[model samples]
Target: MTTRDTTVAVFRPDDERLRDAVELVESLGATPVADPMLEVRETGASPRTDADYTVLTSKTGAEIARETGWEPGETTVCAIGSATAGALREQGYDVDLVPDEFSSTGMVELLAERVDGARVEVARSDHGSQVLLDGLEAAGAYVHETVLYELVRPEGAGGSAELAASGDLDAACFTSSLTVANFLAAAEERGIRADAVAGLADAVVGVIGEPTRETAESEGIAVDVVPENADFDELACAVVERAAPTYHD
Candidate 1:
């Protein structure tokens, strides 16, 4: 008999990213469950203008910074990843540095040699990692952070939890640490937390990168795939390929 159809769950915001995720799943010949786990709340805050170096960690942060008309001026600009760099460029901001690896650790590594005695401004979300701040400080830079946005789980999430609990899901793609936490929160709200976690143990669970994988595993969710590249398309493609190997158009 033909295998059952593949169904992949994605937890992106309820914006264009989710739409793109749905289309990507469809293109991969798997049914998409678009359950947004996180919502963006802009904080109306921008990075300090007097920093010798400035770091932005997300596309959302970059967009918000540009919207606030925050100029980089003479500050050396840094991005955590290519996506953030691209966002800065699209917002008419020139980016000076992007780490070879797209992570807090990578950002620290890239700046560890140059930021001695410099004033560094890190502007991102409320969930910004301490690793970045601590590393910069240890390297003799005075690092300050501004919260550009906060990520809160949307109200009507967790549909995918039900699907997973019932064994209807083939795979899941988690993009960030917050997404993993919010997904569990949604599952708990639906009273299927245990079952959902058990079901995921049997399914192909893909996370975007090391941090997300650590978050998932810390929650007792066995992550099955993590692409070398820390991006959605890479995560989705790797998950879909594993979940729908025999799927035909």
Candidate 2:
């Protein structure tokens, strides 16, 4: 592996998770460009209790649901990923279903056969993909979505984009499609969208999963790393390894 110094850009929310991500990058001997692209705005809403199935797509949604007194009394609870499941369990909600793939497509696939003709309530951020709702509807289920929160780009969040434009970004870990969109928007705001994209082409770009990868690719970003499991830690590790491939004898 190359021992050369690496500077990686991370776009996690400005919270504990961001700190953890920066710590992970440091442990891998890379300089971290800590920029928060997503900010959570709670909508003060909760899942309806009448649904036959309840879906939570993110950790923020689960946390907000718990905060808003959403008790899943007899409702078959589903989570999009392990982190969301863990959040539900932490709040004393029993998670009954977790898709193997950990994405909207995965959730729809997991419930397609079983949720036919059933009432499925999806409670999540406003940035959720229409694919989930359309897939569930096509599978013959009645789907209702409640926006638990909204994910917005934090103000003045494109410093990393400028760094990337200047050719200082060695890698970027994009955890979601919205983050990719937000990053580009910030870059565009700074009038450096083209330069930033060009710079990113010269560096290793890693996305959390297929959905994120698709979004990045659709925007002309070349994705170099996608971990088998769609989680932040796994994504981060894979990207770091790509930035400076693992050494061997």
Candidate 3:
């Protein structure tokens, strides 16, 4: 039996997407741990009136807005990527723009062509990166942001912290800055060493976007791979390949 000590810790909510990552890990014969660091909560309402554009960056955003309800009719919906666009479309929102690249900067670039001086409301995580908001505002879009959710880790990560403390994890996947921050907070709560987490600099530390990569680097974690896009599937495949190439089924 080729028992690999590699483990890929996914700090995402226990959504279908988490399951997808778990399946990917199993296909590679590696252990998959569900170590969610953030909880997504859809809050508030359409804070702006007659928003010419609505920007959704994650599936949680789409679901929150859909559940909260919005005025019917065509509102140019811009998404960070295809996956988010699909999520918006499935929820009955007409997706007008889905950038080729996946990031707030990407979405801002995509919106430049269709909006300028137009009121735009962004449904985003409570702790959001300023790139998108700054870029869009610079591009002359009337940007308003609504904190749709917060990402928090589960009560305790079981004994996963001990594994990372001992450098047992071959890799860890951080999909968002919140996930990265929350994961570190959880580790500290469990008395894990900073070096043990940073050791992934030599191993596989997967990030979903530039912002996430930047955060990981700042935390002294070696980021071995960042997908071409921010889609979870793209990230999952990249992490699996980087950490356990031979384990791939």
- When 1 and 3 are scored with TM-score, the better candidate is 1
Highest lDDT model number: 1
TM-score of every candidate relative to the true structure: 0.97, 0.96, 0.90
Name the regions of candidate 3 deviating beyond 4 angstroms. 1-5, 44-49
- Show model 2 residue runs off by greater than 4 Å: 1-4, 246-249
lDDT string, candidate 2, 1-249, tens digits: 252378888999998889999998888777888999999999888899999999999888888998999888888999999999998898888999999998899999999999889999999999899999999999999999999998999998998899889998889999999999999999999999999999999999999989899999999999999999878889877887888875211
Q: Candidate 1 regions off by >4 Å?
A: 1-4, 247-249
For model 1, how does the per-residue alpha-carbon lDDT over 87-136 read when each residue is reduced to its tens digit? 99999999999999999999999999999999999999999889999999
Write model 3 residue lDDT over 1-249, tens digit each, in one string. 232566878777877777887887776677787776666655665434468888888877777777777643556777877877888788887877788777877787888766788888887777767888898888888888988776656677534455677767677788887777777777787667575575555467888888888887888777888888677767777887778776645
Worst 10 residues of 1 by lDDT: 1-10
- lDDT preference between candidates 1 and 2, better one: 1
For candidate 3, the clash count comes to 7
Task: State the weakest 10-residue window (summed lDDT) of model 3.
Answer: 40-49
Per-candidate clashes, comma-separated: 0, 0, 7
lDDT of 2: 0.90
